[model samples]
Target chain A: MNDLAFRLRDARATLSAVAVFVALFALYTLNHPAGFSANVVQTAANKGVLLAFVAVGQTFVVLTAGIDLSVGAVFILANCLASVVVTGSPGAVALGVAAVLGTGLACGLANGALVVYGRLQPIVATIASGAIYFGLALALRPEPGGDVDSTLADAVTGQLAFGVPASAVVLLAVMLLVWVPFRRSLIGRAVYAVGSAEASAYLSGLPIRRARLLAYASAGLFSAMGGLMLAFFTYSGEASASNASTYTLDSIAAIVIGGVSLFGGAGSAVGAVFGALIFRTINDLLFVFDLDPLWQPLFLGLVLLGAVSLGSARLLRLKNRLELFGS
Target chain B: MTVPTTPVAPAPASPPMSAPARRRFDPAVATAFGCIVALLLLGSLYSTRFLSPDYLLQQLQVGSFLALVATGLMVVVLLGQIDLSVPWIVTVGGMMATAAAGHGPLGAALAIPFGVLCGVAFGLFNGLGVAYLRVPSMIFTLGVDAVAQGLMVLKTGGSAPQDMATPLMRDLATGRALGPVPNAVWVWLLVGTATSFLLSRTTYGRAVYAVGNREAAAYLSGVRTRRVTLAAFALSGGLSALSGALLAGYSGKAYQGMGDGYLLPAIAAVVLGGTSILGGRGTYLGTTAGVILITLLQSILSVVQMPDAGRQVIYGAVILAMLLLYGRGAKIGA
Candidate 1:
């Protein structure tokens, strides 16, 4: 009975967010010019997957009660590096992919080291690292033009059999390979324990530091994957500060919409993916409805505020005002 | 629901000292002073022109803008909260002031106040979200930021404004009085002094620090934590808006994204001034020094012809190094 209750509680936020997304997606499909068509789905999938990968990364760090503001920087860094390195022969492209991912891991490790060992606040530390990463990206691609391995890019970004999005398939493959294994691992449980109650987790002899480190490192790895996908989509690299900052903000929005608590310790990468899709669909919905592009930011802001307000509804029921501070 | 056996304790380990010592000397201020002197020496090595009053004062004029924004950010930071709506609030202030100025003499005269009031109103919205709604300040301010951006975009119709700054604004921003000192520097000094007084001398200031240290405890001890939070945020907004209005005056017109570059630097400046990022500890003098340091650093970087990428890298590295240095002593999230 206790185990059942725990599972239900854990799933509640994710479930509600999913319900909201489903309704919105339905609304989007109904209004779109080519309603429910493969082309529409593929386009939405392509756009959504980039944020999904980054949101998944954000989930890892936020789950540990920390945030990785550097994810977007790493994403852009990977994009620039990949554009430069992922050209030439097929063999060379593979090496480039590895190198891009490796750089992302290094960035994540740097953030983790500062937060865990140097004892700097996660937000500020990542903000600093993010600047460095973005600087490196700007140096790599001073202008916006570069070439990627077209064959590899096309294979990953194109439609699969029967009009399925190859991007969607790749996203699923990633979840299976990365998130699922981590979710089941002992370290995964420790990540939750630490977020929920650090003192208790420490008392239980958990490898608290290692769990936090792994969470940050994995976040970096996923962010790099997102970057690679971005390069594939654009077929070039642009070190635009505005774009990097937007992605960072959007990733946070995705996590919130996906039912991940900013206060930490609950949510899944799958839920985050759903959240990213929902956020992207909102943008797509604007297009279908023919709203002014100027209205998009305002509409997004309202949605975010409403979602956050809804999340805070639990505060009203508290008996002690002290609980208000913690919540 | 069963409460955990051991309650999650707050992170106050060994307080930096047994009691808050009333030390006349702050190491942060002293260090900042030293850095300023060191930089002057270093820059003179590049060119004798660097030591000229005209050149140094010019840097101060520009530094004044950042110092104004940092003043507000420091207040919010003191409450252990952050306000990310600064960029847009700034834009709104400048836009509103400049747009208002085009109407009539009254509009021109009230342009600065009109801009500041706009910021105060937005700050109230930010405050309500944080204090009353219990929304996290970071996310709430970000949402406010987007809303502000949209409003500005709609108002401007996706282009530069058709209006320009009034003569009064132009004078306040660019005109110099007292011979060598730019008018903006005087304005910055005035704002800095007022902020220092508010943070160090007033009852509200004491309440701010108390709330920052521990909100629940402060509340229990009869501090109106919500009111303090609301006031701090409002003040922060007003100051940021004031800076924006001055910037409009400086440039002689309002433009989009005028405040984009200020956000990170303002935050960094406040932190550099020895104001804790986590809040409840810091001084305005430190922030002032930090602003000067940052401005001088920018001048130095540009003199060397470093690319934008290199400048950003150095800024980021500086933030990280400062945090590590300051944070090592504080038991953050142990």
Candidate 2:
């Protein structure tokens, strides 16, 4: 019974965010009058799929108390490479997928190399690396215009059985895969230990370096996947696609909103996925309201700020309870 | 090179080396400096134009603004915070100064001050959130950056400044004084010198360093950590604005994204100059070298006709190698 309660309490962050999503959707429905339309649902599903994927990538890195600023840049680089290498042939699409995944892996390796052996702080190292990657992407295409396989895009992103978005299925699959290890795997628990206390983790003989390197690598790969899906949605190769650069922050906000600790050692992948969904709903609601695009960033930042402080406040209250109870 | 200082708990009792030996070479500083030198040397060898003093001086002049802004970043880094708002602030400041020059010389004066104050106000806002409000500087500065960037875009209407107001401004950028030394070079020298002196000699400087090294300790020592932090952000904002104003005078105009180019380089210079990103240790000298090195490399590459992306790849790789070599030095300095 106690274990059940603990598990239930652990899930509160996801539940709360979902509740917010429902409330916001309600408000939007009242205002739009034509709400619950299939198109709106499909758009939300598509947006949520892309955002959820990116947030999942961020989850691993943030779990280890580091960040990957280069994710957006890497996302762009993968697309650029794909646009250059991919073509009309089925083999070309296959190669394109391999090439993009390879690009992501290589970029992650570069970041991991610097961060691990170079003893570089993840944020600074990734920022510089991001600039270089972005520079390369710009140099490669400079301007935006390249075609991805429409068939491939449609197949992956189009509706599934019962008219559910295919991309939504992919996102759900990722969440399922993540949840298993996150609960039972020692490596996953090691990540939490490392984030909560680095030196302690090291002293305990964990492969802190390997874990960190792999975490960033996973982040890179997942971010690339996100970019692939994003490209499918846009259907055009844009070297300047990541120029908006808010995608990185947006992913992070999604994670935080879902109840992940910024200081690390807490949270779930599913929580992050749910966070992205709520955020997507809020953003869609804003569009329904005809609010300025600029307001999205401001609103996202404010919500993230509130979510984080609230999360911290809850932790503090728990700490107080533990102190009083002498747990 | 591990000092074996308590990483927050008891360690195996082992005296690794003499305390002085542990003290001399901070790995991070050494690595960053090594990267700078290696890049400088490689740049010099790769391009025939690098041998020419005339070619070299041109890069130095162009590099001054980056160095100036970086020196301010160095101070902030000492406090273990990052400021990403410099680019737009510089661009806006330059734009304001250029536009105000039409108001006459007096207007130029007003505009320049206004630019600095604009940055200062933003910095104070940053200080308020990061210091008093206990917010993460990253989120606060980035948010501030977005707000500033939006205002700049709104102000410029996504176009370049139509009127730069004077030939004097361009002359300031291009004119040479004593033996081919550019005016911008002189400006860089003064800023570097003054900053170095202020950081090294003054009580405030020491206090800043102390606060950065250990805020709790500094406060326990009654060093008014809040004021020092506020001042650090203020200085960062002010210097960024000053650099922007000068660039405006040099470029004879300001574009919407003019300061964008300088942002990364400014941080790069500070980091390469041996300033620990985690803060508490830095010097104007390292920042000076950093600016010079980046300028030299970029100029040499331009002469060699290497694409910017290629240069960047080499640059990133080089910086990484250097960090690997000297990261230990950085932690000690931190």
Root-mean-square deviation (CA) per prediction = 4.5, 5.5
- Which tens-of-lDDT digit does each residue in A149-206 have in candidate 2? 8898888878877777788888778667765765577777778888888778888888
Model 1, B145-216: lDDT tens digits are: 988888888888766555598887788899996788999999998988888888888999999999888999
Highest-scoring model, TM-score: 1
Q: What DockQ values do the models have?
A: 0.56, 0.28
Best by lDDT: 1
Residues B1-334 of candidate 2: C-alpha lDDT, one tens digit per residue: 7788657866645556774464465454555556556765766677555657786688888898888788788888888887877877787677766677768678765776776787787778767666655555666666666566766665665355544735655565677866689988887888888888888789888887887787877777878887888888888888887788778878767666677777667777777777787778766666776777677667666667777678767666655554455433323112
Q: Can you give the lDDT of residue B117 in candidate 2?
A: 80
Deviation in Å, model 1, residue B207 alpha carbon: 0.8
lDDT comparing candidate 1 with the true structure: 0.87
Model 1 residue A60 lDDT? Answer: 94
